[model samples]
Target: MSLITFHRIYPSAIPPMRGDKSALGSLPAAAFQYCEAIRTASSFGWYVFPPLDIELKFDGAEVFCFAEESGWNKLSSLYFEDEFWREWDRFAPDDMKGYRIPYLTTLFVPGIVQIWSGLLVSTASDYSVLVRPLANVVSHRGYQVYEGIVETDRFAPCPLFINIRLIDTSRAIEVYQRDPLFQVQAIHRSCYADGGAYAEKIGLGPPDGVTHGMSATEWDGLRSTIRSAQPLRDSQIGRYGAAVRKRAKGQENID
Candidate 1:
């Protein structure tokens, strides 16, 4: 079982707001359904979530949004603590220059700020984790953005970020002091004790006694030199389709 340790970096960050039956006077059908799902997933070692919230703001948007070369010097003072975001501006690459577009009057906002300023840790040695934005808040802005799969090791854990793309950039948006920002889902890898036996059982081989795994045709299929070519094992789905067809034929004969 994998474990995630969520430490509250800032004192202001708060747990996500969960509306439960006991807290509320009455519960809706969806709320009850979600609660049941949470309970069921918890038993099987899943972190359905209540991720830590991080603060982000586009301070003095009116002024910074209009800033050019002459106004660029003044744009640095727009962050919560003026100097706090300075380091980010310096290290950001040319492509990421658009991220600090407060210097330029632009329609799209980039890198408003990094929410989590500190570190996060995961117990899993090497794993793929997902960072998802709060669904309710994601729809607040017209366009939805997805964060890629983060690979976590013993070193530094992946920090979550909020990517908000507004349909109407003119409208001012604010993330309250303690609003839930994002959630993290730790993706688990599928494991099999005996790979050879499993593949044979799945109908991709020359049966149990004939061969352990990887039939002659399957091995020959892997001889492709193309880097983007699909693996031979991918075609193993045909095994299941064949089984279904055989079962249908048997049923027709009986009928």
Candidate 2:
């Protein structure tokens, strides 16, 4: 099996772990039984934790980062190398002439900010990594997480951080050391090929359709599936999830 690992890069760094059911802990038991989509998504990748506790406050003009622990006074105040920032600014687009946002900047723009995850991720040689917000769980206090895919195999042990766009800046946002900050999932490098066949759909659609190839008999079957028709038997509520699990297990049988 291909292995993915996370290295703790700082004294307060915490290693990532498989996502749990906390995101769905508030849902009623009955309501959660059929939440396979959310459950699957939440558990698909590992959760990345923050290195320290911080509270970010905004007054419609600027953002201030504060820390209440020793050796961690603030996020942006932490020391960072300027090598990448210098090179990036030099080759930046002409339109962004006067914009120079540092990698460790607490505030990138008026309402956008960056947070250091304090972890380095490593993956198999042929696989990359996708770093993004927790799937199906919204806990932003006042901002929205951004998604970024990195060819981590190139850098191997890549630094993992997060950038969020402020949505409701009227309140202060806090990040606890015990809480998850982001998520990381592995993806094959081949998925990024120039002309890869990423997906296909069969129907009378505007694009990516096989309208001319779908025969009447095929459409009848497809329609029945979409309509959830069970004329021969009673309909099932979690039938889609059951079918998905069956497909995932394939034809394998365990005794």
Candidate 3:
């Protein structure tokens, strides 16, 4: 079975960077509880919570837009340390230079992961689990929305980028401390492939099951008798062994 593991580059908790005057404070206990639940729920995947707080403010239409000709169209105002931003930016595809879309403003992601082979990791909205920015934290904060999904290598450990984008440009939003900024789900790599054929048809089913294998009605009767409330004595055990040998011989004859 494959596994996914996480590591935090920052040793201590960091405070969220604010573009405006939103006050930073400890989030509700429910926020941390929800994250813990997701973290320990299963062995297949894990959750990465925000190590620090973050905020973005959009004053009406001034800082966001869908207009291709507008300077404020789809801008990312989120900020992080220069070194951290540089490190995460290293993973961006080189062909991005030719793309005309708004540049993905890099932020210092709170977590990293060792994405395993035979699995893929993708992002989910933090709001899905009730982890979100401070409500009504600022005027015009509703304009920006967090971006979804980051590219992950199926077999290597890499830094996870928490990307955001402007949606309405009507308001501002803040990501509080301990918020679940990035959610990762592991997917079997085979899911991406086209299934070839049934296992039994491909000679991959259980070796001695009914499908393509032997059938001994006497063995079935013996199994039923053993499973019943009646206690088995030495005589019954001896009979079972004889039945097993008989079944093996019958299977050999069929082969």
Candidate 4:
């Protein structure tokens, strides 16, 4: 049997408040339930990574999110590859900015079910493209935003949980082929020492833990890109609002 290790990436903007004894203490039970619902519905294993010290502050947001060290490491290492950087520079908001946080926190749903022990590839230039499979197959919906709700007398800031799932990649690719925003590449199956494996059976090298933190220069580049693309992002979001709304409403009915 192949061992598949799963990792969860939380937004780095909302960390626990100071002196909050419980990690989930400030978070809503509803949010936790929502996460559980996705896990159960997807039949995929997942767990929250230990809290790390990274903190992000947005212009209007009150609470800051804390990202686990591993999570930061994973993202930083991915950004180091030239190919990954090139693509990320083209698409992501933070690519040209100075270490800005992602507006959205991403979740990974494995494409292959019977994966052997997999390494969280930090340095592979190809892994950046590999992530397309997950992005292509995964669906998000049911976003209910609660603003300034208090749970157990502790303040819980606005929390949003959208139901998410992994669609059949074959079907997704068929549809995705027509979209201008995404492209599907050929899938490859192979093996490596770091236990990298995928549904397409692609193999990757061992993880490099060394360069997990983004430098100031990289952060600046990302910020610049975000500023330049603001109008485009707004336009896309506006045009796709109806479709997004439909998906959100239909999430519960997906199973």
Candidate 4 Cα RMSD after full superposition onto the native fold (Å) = 26.6
Badly placed stretches (over 4 Å) of model 4 are 6-39, 60-255
Model 1 agreement with the true structure over 1-255: per-residue lDDT tens digits: 645554443233354333232222234445433443332222222112212322222333422322233432322223223353465556658665424312112233453332342334454754555555543232345334345456555444544333434334444444334444444555643331135234324355556776566667766755432233378543432333344445756844321
Could you give the C-alpha RMSD of every candidate to the true structure, in order shown? 15.2, 8.1, 16.7, 26.6
The TM-score of predicted model 4 comes to: 0.16
C-alpha local distance difference test of each model: 0.39, 0.68, 0.36, 0.26
Between candidates 1 and 2, the one scoring higher on TM-score is 2
lDDT tens readout by residue for model 3, 13-126: 332222111112233444323332222222223334444444443454333223224433434433334555455456558754232211224233321111111122322222
Output the TM-score of candidate 3: 0.34
What number of clashing residue pairs does each candidate have, in the order they appear? 0, 0, 10, 29
What clash count does candidate 2 reach?
0
Candidate 2 error regions (>4 Å): 1-3, 21-31, 68-76, 79-104, 197-201, 204-210, 215-233, 246-255
* lDDT, candidate 2, 142-246, per-residue tens: 778888888878887877778787666677677787978888899887787678645555566334435345667877877545524567665566655666666
Candidate that scores best on TM-score: 2
The lDDT-based order of candidates, best leading, equals 2, 1, 3, 4
Decide which is better by lDDT, 1 or 4: 1
Candidate 4 local lDDT, residue 14: 26
In model 1, what lDDT does residue 205 have?
A: 52
Per-residue error (Å), model 3, residue 240: 37
